[model samples]
Target: DGQKVTVIATDYTCIGEPVEINVIVSDLPNAFTPGSDGFNDIFGAGAELTIFNRWGQVIYEGTEGWDGKYKGKKVSPGTYYYILSVFDANNTKTTMKGSVTVVSDEK
Candidate 1:
């Protein structure tokens, strides 16, 4: 799981005072092996995960994470795109986008 974040603004009165908002995208592990032994059953990063198909259609979206399945069925091994959004304690949002590959057990 990713770390929890916090943000605080000292001066809320100042409009466009150049508030320094830091956005950091942690490099999560690119791949996970979700075996059927009840360990690592979910194959996704801990942050908010959004998966898009090759045609740019969002296939899955959730906060608990992706379990390498869609609509209660396992997805075939292939490449997919993911967008992870992390929010700080002060409600600052940071989003990270990347790609990942899912491999079958035989491979």
Candidate 2:
């Protein structure tokens, strides 16, 4: 969703023109490669992210990012479900659920 914010300044006898700002929230990537080549090595969406495997088991949870690992081991390349929670500028929390695929460039 797109939201707009307006700001204005006023004094005892004067008022400045109002300014409009657009707030745009970006969507997380559908996939990432944890190969550590400095590109797409970590996946994250918000301040908190919880990822689960297809079997409904929690695989990863943290604020930092997921390196496609579980229990310090790299998970197989595949799709994983995730729940992301984030706070906006006003500290309003929003939660999102989606899937993200883990990719590997290694042979």
Candidate 3:
């Protein structure tokens, strides 16, 4: 999640223009494993997440969480992109984009 802040400048003469700023307040993981061992088995955030493949194809879209599967099959281990749409308390939507690697099970 993130927040929007407005800063105004005043120097005893008059108020200056307000500068709007978008502040990021969440840290997402760079990798995860859906090996069904109950440890990092799902990837999720406090917002609507849309996952995409390297070719810009959507693999998953929802808030429930991704189990590293597409169409009932496990995805190949690699880096995938994501777009997170977070709405702040002020109803301002912020989009955060990044990549998360899917680690294959060693066993």
Q: What does the lDDT come to for candidate 1? A: 0.70
**Residue 56 of model 3, lDDT score:** 98
Which lDDT values do the candidates have, in the order given?
0.70, 0.85, 0.86
In terms of lDDT, model 3 sits at: 0.86
Full ranking by lDDT: 3, 2, 1
Candidate 1, residues 1-107, lDDT tens digits: the string is 33444554555676443343444557665665545756555645456889987778888898877877878777777788899888765677788888877666544
Better of 1 and 2 by lDDT: 2
Q: Estimate each model's TM-score.
A: 0.66, 0.77, 0.73
Q: Pick the candidate with the highest lDDT.
A: 3
Candidate 1 residue pairs that clash: none
Tens digits of per-residue lDDT, candidate 2, 49-101, equal 99999998999999898889999888998999999887666667788899999
| TM-score, cand. 1 vs. native | 0.66
